[model samples]
Target: MSDTVLDEWQIALKQKKTELEKCQKEHHVESCLKCEKLLNCEMRETYVKAVYDSMSKGKGGGFEF
Candidate 1:
């Protein structure tokens, strides 16, 4: 692939990742029991970040953000 095409693909992938993170944050706020159980705000933030990182790769298959 040409450099331009590769760059575009990278950008699109990054945008999708951002969108996925946003959706996860919204869902966590609304329904995640683990998030609700969080006592410290920082820990909750870290947990959310970890969850996003883990699930963003589409590892388990059929699990869309």
Candidate 2:
């Protein structure tokens, strides 16, 4: 087994991903795009933020993509 530890941002991203998946399961949808609340979902918003934070390592910056 791997003994690697997750840092704060990764931990938060993991948590948000779990919550997002749970919501999807409860809604019986495979993707968030299939959900009606795709636009105004707080869960999705937080999850997106968590993803960005994870990519940026908590550093506030814009990507060049």
Candidate 3:
């Protein structure tokens, strides 16, 4: 097993990703774009938030490329 430890942001992102993938599988869709609940899906919203948080390391501000 890898000995590297994940930061809080990475851990949260991983958990959210797993949930999102499970939801996608249950819905039988490869992408959320094809899902009918794409607009109001709390799961997707949470996953998106997790993505942003992971990128920003919990820093609340605009992201730079």
Q: Which ten contiguous residues of candidate 3 have the minimum total lDDT?
A: 56-65
For model 1, residues 1-65, the per-residue Cα lDDT tens digits are 55554344345455655664565587566433446445545544554554554555424434454
Candidate 3: regions farther than 4 A off:
none
Candidate number with the higher TM-score (1 or 3): 3
Q: Pick the candidate with the highest TM-score.
A: 2
Clashing pairs in 1: none
lDDT of each: 0.51, 0.97, 0.96
RMSD of 2: 0.9
lDDT against true structure, model 2: 0.97
Instruction: Order the candidates by TM-score, highest first.
Output: 2, 3, 1
Residues 1-65 of candidate 3: C-alpha lDDT, one tens digit per residue: 99989999999999999999999999999999999999999999999999999998998798787
TM-score of candidate 1 against the unseen true structure: 0.36
Q: Model 2, stretches more than 4 Å misplaced?
A: none
How does model 1 fare in lDDT? Answer: 0.51
Q: What is the lDDT of residue 60 in candidate 1?
A: 42
